[model samples]
Target: MTCRVLLADDHAVIRAGVRAMIQDIDDFTIVGEAEDGKETVEMARELEPDIILLDISMKKVSGLEALQALNRHSPECKVLILSMHTGPEVVLEALQKGAHGYLLKDAAAFELRLALEAVRRGDRYLSSAIVQPVIEQAVSKVNSNAEHTLTQRQLEILRLITRGESTRSIANGLGLSVKTVEAHRAQIMKRLQIHDVPGLVLYAVREGIISPDD
Candidate 1:
């Protein structure tokens, strides 16, 4: 079966390079091109492409933002993020936002073919260059089991603490005594092996306990 693809990137040169690479693969065709996230989402809805090769950085809206929109509006169209960034946070965020695959921009042309084929076959794909780091992060998180270790109350307090809430305020908000709130905070730090507020915040973000926006 022919696979229809939509290319979304701000740079024409990058788009052209990807277009050239896709041309080498059999049964794959570029159905549309979008220069930004908004256009990408719009084209995706209009074209209903089998796959989208999307860049993370764009002018109007970011690829991550587009992924969220596509998740809600174009659930069937697979999105493969084509980005220069190899950060674990970025890759994880894209996947969490509903991307089917994540490919580094510097990947070999053949890797692109492999990624497309994998996503087309209803499987998730990650660039070989990034797979190790992603796995290591996952392993680290699994070893910690930070999410499962904390009780719901502890998790709630941790979220509030990460948001810069003071013990007095937390106690007031949760209708607990000031001393009780302090004890909970101390326990949270000890359990996570974090010595300070900033460290706790970083751990919270990394463990997916709280988003940066939260």
Candidate 2:
């Protein structure tokens, strides 16, 4: 059976290249293409594609956020992240957040094919190059003196708050009550040992959760 795919990439050239590479494959069909994360989610919801190829970088919402949304809204649809970022943390975080596969952008198309096929079968797929590093990073975290802990919801709250979003804005964005948003913000600061808004933003930036320009 062929897998229907929703292709998402910010760059028109990259999207075209992907279409050219995979359109001829007997088992893959291009059901839709999206240029940004919002469009990606819309296509996923509208087309109900079997798999979505998500690019990490995009204009509005990042692919990571879109993956989280898809996982929550369309649990059956598999998400495969194709990114240029090779950070072990990014790969591990994406996998943990429900991405079925993580393949670097530089990987061969054969590897892309393999990843999609593997994830289609309900198995997780990580590129061979980053597999060891991801594993080691996980192991090191377990063996470290630092305690790493945060729920997915908590991480989402942290991201928004650090970006200087007001509580009401965050509540509206995440569909939560303002009070609940404030509670999450408090919990985040307490956990991170940050008492100041500026400190929270700085921590978010240092942790790669947000950029300085964000």
- lDDT per residue for candidate 1 within 104-201, as digits (tens), equals 99999889998899888765677877765764564455445445378788999998876656677789999999899888888988887765554565
Candidate 1: segments with Cα more than 4 A from true spot: 143-214
| Model 2 lDDT-worst window of ten | 139-148
For model 2, the local distance difference test gives: 0.79
Provide TM-scores for the models.
0.67, 0.66
Q: After superposition, how far is residue 150 of candidate 2 from its true place, in Å?
A: 26
TM-score between candidate 2 and the true structure: 0.66
Residue 40, model 1: lDDT of 95
Per-residue lDDT of model 2, residues 45-137, tens digit only: 899999999998999999989988898888888898989898988987787777877888887778878887777766567788886676556
